[model samples]
Target: MTATTAAPAWRPAAPVPCAAPLPAVDRLRVAPRADGWTVTARVAVDPRDPNLAGHFPGQPIYPGVFVVETLCQAMAQAVPGTPRLRAVTSIRFLAALLGGDEMELTLDVDPAAPAAGAASPTEPGWTVRGTGRRHDGTVTAQLRAVFDAGAGA
Candidate 1:
């Protein structure tokens, strides 16, 4: 089943730390590559999104946690099956994404990798590295996450 068809069954088993409702992915694009896949998503910042409130009160910059959630959601929609988030290996906020500032997330996923240092060498896993940037070219965030190998099954 492709991601689109499996959407209803996919849910995050891990507790997402996002303080507000997950951002809606306005657009999703996926391309199969020799190594794995390339996934991109567009997120529109809603000025009234609850995430903006209290995040700063006066200066609402989109929370970094929400950015991570957006990335995870995008990956789930880009591939089949729900990706059980195993670990967020890395996350960095180079710039702030403020209310009404749209951003695009791009991910390069390696789906056939074994879990790094897994107890069993055959344990399946995926490594995703990606970035979020504004339309004007301001790179706002960069992140990496690991997921169980059972996805796309």
Candidate 2:
């Protein structure tokens, strides 16, 4: 008996619409301090963002990864010269960031010991740590990352 290998009823599905890319940050403010630098950034969570679409589907919440990216981007803008991320040493999500929530990230950038073998005479490393708080002052997330002071002259 010969077996026929025929494809069964394959129909192309309709194209799904895509959400527009959200900006890295809505507002950014940086200030210098004796200990380090303080960076404050605002982000408006849009329910229509792709990251929220399937994050909880019926109940959308801002993804934690986006929070980290937000902080990293803020650090890049707040620091002198370019900063290259070496590692995310720690991250914690304390509360849920819901759609329509306006979150304020307050990050502190301070000097840190460079990775053991990664340090050089001319370059230094920095640690960025901060918390994301809702407009009402509810802490939602915290993160810490190490970065190399990039491309020193």
- Write model 2 residue lDDT over 1-153, tens digit each, in one string: 112533223222212122223454677766665567777778889988876788888888988888876766666666776576778888999988888999888888887754433335235777877888998889998888878776553
Clash-forming residue pairs, model 1: none
TM-score of 2: 0.74
Candidate 2: where is the Cα deviation over 4 Å?
1-21, 114-123
lDDT of 1 by residue, 51-79 (tens): 67778787777788888778777766676
TM-score of each: 0.77, 0.74
Evaluate residue 47 in candidate 2 and report its C-alpha lDDT on the 0 to 100 scale: 88
- Candidate 1's TM-score reads 0.77
lDDT of 1: 0.72
